[model samples]
Target: MTRHETFARPTIADKDFVLATDLDGTFLGGTEESRRKFYSWIEESRDRVGLIFVTGRDPGHVRDLTRRRGVPRPDYVVGDVGTTIAEVDDEHFLAPIAPLEAEIAAAWNDAGMRVQAALRSVPGLTLQSSGFRFRVSYDMDPDRFDDRAFDIVAELGLDALVSADRYFDVLPKGVSKGPSLLRLLTHLGVDNRKVLVAGDTLNDLSMLTMGLPAVAVGNSEPALISALEGMEHVHRAREEGVGGIAEAILHHKLLQ
Candidate 1:
């Protein structure tokens, strides 16, 4: 798992490529060597491969990673668990996803404060301060989670994604990583076929199911692997973290 193997170099004939990946166990889960190799490839292929971060993290959290962990700065970020999207520049300022925000926000039936008040009494649900215009997150004790809480979300026309057995995220009913990523792709005019998605958990399920080439890292949650079972153009990598991602890139012949 610690091997630092590099894949074939990008060819001149290679078409434009975009990599949309979840952080946590997917991007940051690999061995140091594998991560370094992946980062080197990204830095070297900057012109041919566009890097995007499709994460549940907020903008500030994402910024911290790039600043402290040497994570490559992303061209765009779909953060707040896909409720927010922004274009990032070299200087690290984020330009809000204009024109699309209105559409995405229409799904929020009530103010975040209102939703918070409604769910406050739900046992085992602790609000996470990392929230944005259309998303609210909470840590839940799965054993204590009550269907009534979800009922409240449904009544309010919101959707909930519970992942890793603990995170309870509430967002607009129709918004998720997949649709948000696709929206960003359309805005950038990137062909779907030229994209490769990577993830390792249930929250990442939407992006993996998008039918673009995908990589499920070896350490992916069982739920994710089960959900992705029999899917085409999806590679279940043997290596964990970026090593798995590297394997998928080679398998798909994206860099040769």
Candidate 2:
């Protein structure tokens, strides 16, 4: 709590709209031309627009994504599939909010080894190399993936999240992107009404359906679209990726 509590930086309170978005497909989606335009707009409207990258990516990946990839950096990042809530310092290093993460840490309880031991031989799931602190992610080949993996995680009192029909994640119960993002915003006293949540996969569902102004980008997977069906709060955009995000910002009239 002490590391960043007293730190100072411009807050989202000053902005008219804050984008709490997922990477890979939502923000980084759209044509190269469209991405450039949207990026430029946010950079130009820094005073009015605030950005937060809420993704399954680890802090190191997030840092590299923005620092070396030329993407506009986020003011805050809810990374590691929501196990980590951090602020991007002046140097792009993540300063995790220690207090906010206490619950997630407690819930995880060093379950990684147990989880690995249990699922080591499961078919169709290849371990991802990241070695994240709070979650275990595997790349899944749906054809041979054992559905029992879900049951195993549940038995261990953890949550198993399968998204994009290709990725599997074991996370602490009740800890995911949505809850973590809400926690960060509430901690910062940012108005929920002015925040727009966006995503393109099943992993993003928890946040997208939290009753905020949200969007399922056009490029979203079928599982997510089915889940969001008839949910009036979510805008099922016609455009893909950032193009869809741009559309939602207007459809919700968020800029006004």
Candidate 3:
């Protein structure tokens, strides 16, 4: 064992706890002090807390961050906007979510080529490099993007969601962060109540609306905030990024 593993790990009664959070304006958006504190807490309580990164980034980008950035390695990574799920430890991604991927594949077609071909004539729809087996992403001018895009997606049997005003994603009919996360929790045998989801953008709306306790940062997109209105389980934090996450953790008494 390494010297770090030689020490006794911090113990908590709630071993079932899972923190599922989005990146960008949520996990990586806080002040330096708050980020340090949050990272420190995760390091200190590594054994007790299960950390999951629910992000829109591809697995390669996620891997880069895990290797280069100071972010604490997550136990599980739900990447590609939750279409991809992998069990990761400190060094590498070890397990594949085969069943989950298969389910998504059943709904998706042609790696999104069909959707792309359908939308090829649509102006202002620039394809993003984030295309994967379950998702096809794009950057588009919402003003130029008319209902035609929606019709194309629907006709192709896909679901389209726009976030942060520019990111357009075409996903499988039932493949979204909420349902995918629920599936992951079921696979892990973890209760939904034990999991806390956090995010700050419209892309995270589905996960936030999953009826699990959630945290929306102060810097979250206005649309996301509006959508979360009247949702009793979500806590709007005064702080941004990791600070908001910390606030929500305390607000829900999740560690207890």
Candidate 4:
């Protein structure tokens, strides 16, 4: 076995622990080797390192992405920016944690009317329930939008969160990845100290800043890098995308 493999795979009681990573641009970049290594790591470290995917993609899309890429399903999935949390069981997403559904329902209804009206003004834009928020996107851009959309959201007193590229995620005030991660932590009886997070996008900011040992997967955006650089526990990955993930996994000795 390679030295890297020796270091990457460790026993659970050897202080091996869990990792919560963002999926899209971090680990799976729609590449063959990337997908191969990702699944390899997951399968190798399955017993010791609990791989949890904390992504902004909705559950359905996450399922499709995993199936298409041939990656092992995550032990836990924090989808739609923490709108819904679920566990995977052999092609099925089971054991949902719907704690926020009631709150989400109330929050959505409160902002739906105004948000819908504002979204309608943007051509090619349609709204989808993302579990925790409403997502507005255009067909041509899918994520692209002019400055006017943000302005309208501001005027309507709604929160507009941009995940990646040009996509718009509108969440209620105070809903974010940090709290969602906390909820999961509590449910699993895992302390924050035992968690390690890695991400590479705007939506990952909250969990990254939650003071866990977080690594920004790559150069990321200058603004995001700057915002997170000062955190004593945060580290930057040596490589971009999944390479960074591998680096962090090795550097931290997260798996035993």
* Best model number under TM-score: 2
CA-lDDT, candidates in order: 0.85, 0.93, 0.83, 0.69
**lDDT comparison, 3 vs 4, better candidate:** 3
In model 2, what is the error at residue 10, expressed in angstroms? 3.7
Which is the leading candidate under lDDT? 2
Tens digits of per-residue lDDT, candidate 1, 1-256, equal: 3378766754312438888999999888889988998899898878798888999888888888887879999888988778888988777766778776677777775558878988999998999866477888999998888879889988888888988888999889889898898888888778778788999988989989988999999999998899998997799999998888888988988766
Error of 4 at 230 (Å): 1.2
lDDT of 2 at 61: 87
Question: How many steric clashes between backbone atoms does each model show?
Answer: 0, 0, 0, 3
lDDT of 4 at 88: 69
lDDT of 4: 0.69
Q: Over 4 Å off in model 2, which ranges?
A: 1-9
The regions of model 3 sitting more than 4 angstroms off are: 1-16
Candidate 4 — which residues are off by over 4 angstroms? 1-15, 122-157
Superposed Cα RMSD, model 2 = 4.3
Question: What tens-digit string does per-residue lDDT give for candidate 4 at 1-256?
Answer: 8666655543322335777888777766425776687678778767666767888777777778667856667777877776666776676464676664556545555676667777786754556544334433233254345667778877765567775555567665555677677677777667566678888877889999988878888746666687787787778876777777777777766554
TM-score of each: 0.91, 0.95, 0.91, 0.79
Ordered list by lDDT, greatest first? 2, 1, 3, 4
Better of 2 and 4 by TM-score: 2
Query: Model 1 off-target regions past 4 Å?
Result: 1-15
